[model samples]
Target: MKNIILTLALLIPFSGFAQEFPNLKSTRQDEDYSFLKNDTINKNWYKTMKFLPINESKSAYFSFGGDIRFQYFYAKNENWGNGDQDKDGYVLSRYLFHSDLHVGKYFRAFVQLQSSVVGGRIDPSPVDANPLEVHQAFADFNFINEKSKKLILRAGRQELSYGSQRLVALRDGPNNRQSFDGLKLMTGKENMSADFFFTHYVAARDGIFDDKSNQDRQFWGSYFVLNKVPLLKNIDVYYLGYKRAKANFDDATGKEIRHSMGTRIWGKSGNWRYDGEAVYQFGDVAEKNISAWTTSINGGYRFNSIKFHPEIGFKTELIRGDKTKDDSKLQTFNPLFPRGAYFGLASVIGPSNLIDIHPSISFEITKNIDWIIDYDMFWRYSGNDGIYAPNTSLIYPGNTTTKKKIGNQLETEIVWEPNPFLYFRLEATWFQAKDYIKASGMGKNIFFTGITTQIRF
Candidate 1:
């Protein structure tokens, strides 16, 4: 039955002619590419929405943009727990407004304001709620602009993300995106660059002007990207440091300081592509030595000659776990600021102290429509630790059981882009529990469904 379902999914996209869709890429392209990168509005979308039109004047050096989104989610047996309230539904709405101003050839300013709200019967978590706040505000100054070299300095509240977004990201899947209060410096040209930053995460509050940089935590990092590496598409290397005044975990709680260093290499040739990353961490938590690591690898192939331009890929990852409760050192890996949807649409699990194998396939139904299907299997790397949720919350403790096998998940998603300014998506997922969850009194099949729509102007 699974084979039949996958066969049909691979064929659905070839049923009709290819269509064109608007590009929805992020606004963080390299500065050397072009200053008008964000101002290049799509001509196929509504054009009359421009009010000031400074974007149309070559000398004006100012631009404005915004986005609106609506999302709804339904879940059955959330966290594999049994209860009437475990099955729930919720809806979220978000609005973002931003502006950019440039002065002469070296200075620029940017600001973004956002509002997010929740509706429906489900309990609202921190990710789903935040009303009216400054999402980002920053100033940029260029130190060099030669053909072969470039340097930039930026300061104030901003967004930060590194390679692959497995360990660091802006949290785009949630209603309220994440931000940081920081200073950053970038060096190098278009083909190679390095970023150095010092910052603290901005905590989202439910009220205006109440959002503040987390005083108890500090972060610093340097990331390098090499666009042209031999035998590969590119390479990434980074080092990050994190300190928290007080931290908590299954076996301990106290001040913590952690350092992480990692490298990633990825590339594509012909019809095949691949990505691999590994990281090691060391620190002190609760006066105990901390040591942990993680490794991930993913590869895929595209069938261009097939009807739908289908692609299939497999991913495997292993994260370290604490050796024993009596040990003085902690071993669970910590993904500091990972993407919101790191593990597919359901996002029920995090990359911490566990092992996972994921197989996925995607189809380009048309230029405007796409479909994706994923299956994942989970197991505890150390049966003595616990299972952590995508939010880094401890959902099941080690004392709950010594079982290793956790569960399996299946998910499907469809995305539609009618024009450059609008997009829609629908997704559904199911999870089947194994002995581990059942032993913890949280045994049950889980289901999740959601729909989202967004418009840019």
Candidate 2:
């Protein structure tokens, strides 16, 4: 499937050129670079930095860009379990290589590769898997007029990032990143823009082999944006719609196949910014009819170098119905839908799949450095509950009659962004849930820390 998709993507650009389509945006003025525009063509700084010819008469034009990254981490109590005899101190390392090639105005290609080391082992076992794989491999065709004015068409595997939090991200390819395999159509002029996309499955990992399921899953979504409203300058209104089919082998067994639909409204107004989202899901899980809903509101205030953002989010199951009578208590709530995938952290920590409220604040110390502190409070209702386990394969024998109803967690992080292409992030989390870990006799308090670096081009 990967080979076939790659072949088709590569062929599309050639077909566009064969049809006599001219290279777009090759001669357009980039107002953002005023220095280059003011200087003489021969003495332009950008012209001196350019290693390739700038003449349109040249047979070929090529642009080169890529990044390499390295990361290391330290953990106080890596194992969030009992103070037992287990290796809890070790140095983790990861490396990433990414590159992009743009040829004239007809073709563009991207490639990403990653490798990792755990506990001094180069190629660790599955339990220590660090996702060493290819993140993206695709070609693009620009089918828009040279003058930036109207409609545009982009096809093949691509990234579609819209709205504030990237909830309906089609191109979130790979397990770690995210990407979509399909087509995207975009059109806009002035301040209004509209986009449409269709994809197959949400690739969660890097390599083609690390895809969630072997069978191709169907997915489609669309987004519309209106920017710079008259009274709401610097503000944008967005709407999104998406539907996906489960790709697991047991999907036929109704093991929580997801049918999700959601929308969001967000933008910035001076020192204050806000975003809100709502979603609904309907499906059958494990022969039981399932329906659920979720909503969230996030707002922030910026003061000098400090920004405080407090968000409240919630999820509920409206149709537990008669299914609860026959199935085990644990089978009531579907594990597929968590609070929200944001900030690269698990939103809530508890069972019942019920409710969560998170509040966070961040401070910037320097131009390229910042810190974030957040807390998440989780509440689970009776019937069924959920918890995070390091290894899902293990089953624990425990009674939930005495389970705690509230789980409190604290998370802090320091982020350093030296440039657009490179970033270093360090994070630590502490949580307490009496019944969080069923196997561990003591689930009172758990702490863990991780550090990572990323480079993109």
Candidate 3:
């Protein structure tokens, strides 16, 4: 424990002087600090550590950085009081350190180490603990590097996040983030970009360095994005393929193979912003024809003239569900890999076989502080199908109950950023059980409160 404390101390910044530093990316691998290569502009206290020219060559260099995050959750009536609940709460701590080495721009190497821990919990899941492990280790080779266009090939283990992260994500909100072992080819220009990737997701383990890729599960996808569309500011199109040897759903458990095609359009004009996405899926589940789909649209209007500059937003989603468990065709939508906070910080529910309407409002209380509140109402798309967890696993069985109303939730969060290197957040959630929850299982309301502190250097 002492060693862990000592390591986290390194992530604290003595001064908030990172304003001029390279902007941090969601996945650190995409960050570029090459501009610091020039000696004339490299005159910051931390510049020396950020950019280290190898033997004065300047062409080849090294950069080092990391972050420390600690989160605590106090959940009441977990799973609507159906599951075990800790009396007090649980704590999740994560540490990440990385090094980037550039070999003459054409070739580059990156490595990251991770340690996540969970404490005071009734049951610890695999993702809640991984004492220590290699989070990401990858190499990149640039096939074409030019002013107008560029292409790069990357291999080994890495984190993949794209679009709105409804389908594929890094699981950033979880204690132990997800990583994939595979290869990716990326090509892009000023107005367009695309990625082709093939990989197997690594399974999380509680033990140290025991994580490995799941051989029975494979994922491959191609994603394309076009910027500055005529009516829309941006457009994204993607095709994803997934295969799992043994998959379990609300109905029978068996092998599954699925393909998804999706399109997204997003843009902002004046004080109005909109984001819309639609997806269609087709495949085979135990040799049975599979068909499912989902559509989501969100719009927000910023009240710039109002106090605190509040932005009112509304979002709606409809995810297909199987009409019956013993049906000839499976219609349950699969959310491949999605964020943990699909609904709110409680995140008890997932995006499958359901419909949700969310209305929210956010305020910029100050230059460094923000607050948001949202309400979501959920209903099962098909009463014959059950509700799922954030990981797309069945949680509440249909039990032949035909009730459609599941529940409603109210959530609020506040974030404070004193500087560029540190931030603190607080969140609370309440979910009210409805007819379905009462008839199927525990009908208790779920309450959750969370506090998080993150430090980056």
TM-score of each: 0.89, 0.66, 0.96
Judging by TM-score against the true structure, name the best candidate. Answer: 3
How well does candidate 1 score on lDDT at residue 181?
94
Off by over 4 Å in 3: 1-14, 40-45
Residue 188 error for model 1, in Å? 1.6
Writing each residue's lDDT as its tens digit, candidate 3 over 382-448 gives 9888999877789888774788899999999999987667778999999999999888788899999
Candidate 2 lDDT by residue in tens digits, 1-457: 2432443344343332222212212111111121232335455322333223345543233333233333343333333444543344444444445444445565555554544445543333332334565544556565653444445455554444555443443212111334456676767767767777666544444343464421334555566666666654433333333332331211123233455565656676767777766655565545554455555667777774334323222222221111133353223333231223232332223222335567777777676788888777654443233333211112222234435344567888899866444456788777666443533445445565666554433
Instruction: Indicate whether candidate 1 or candidate 3 has the larger TM-score.
Output: 3
How do these models rank on lDDT, best leading? Answer: 3, 1, 2
- Evaluated at residue 221, the lDDT of candidate 1 is 93
What are the Cα lDDT values of the candidates?
0.79, 0.45, 0.87
The best candidate by lDDT is 3
**Model 2 TM-score relative to the real fold:** 0.66
For residues 116-152, what per-residue lDDT tens digits would candidate 1 score against the true structure? 8887755566677888898889998978857788898
**Which scores greater on lDDT, model 2 or model 3?**
3
RMSD of each: 6.4, 10.1, 2.0
Model 1 lDDT-worst window of ten: 43-52
